[model samples]
Target: MIYKVIQINFFMKGIDRGLNNSVVVLLIIQI
Candidate 1:
């Protein structure tokens, strides 16, 4: 159970990073 939770957290972090990267790209394009 603990391992599953850790895996989910890691997956979430990856998704967050992807979102942040896209946002940064959009901002750069706007500028």
Candidate 2:
């Protein structure tokens, strides 16, 4: 559970950097 939160945070960082929004959405969906 902790790892999942961390992973989400990591992806959030990517979003903040203006990374691919769709890819992030897909990843979050998978999670």
The prediction achieving the highest lDDT against the true structure is 2
Worst 10 residues of 2 by lDDT: 19-28
Task: Residues 1-31, candidate 2: write the lDDT tens digits.
Answer: 9999998898888888988879888887978
- The backbone clash count of each candidate, in order, is 0, 0
lDDT by residue (1-31, candidate 1, tens digit) is: 8876776676567677776777556544644
Error of 2 at 27 (Å): 1.7
Model 1: which ten-residue window has the lowest total lDDT? 22-31
| Top TM-score hit | 2
- lDDT accuracy of residue 13 in candidate 1: 70
Measured against the true structure, the TM-scores of the candidates, in listed sequence, are 0.55, 0.56
Off by over 4 Å in 1: 19-31
RMSD per model, one decimal: 10.9, 1.5
Clashes of 1: 0
Model 2 global lDDT (CA atoms, 0 to 1): 0.86
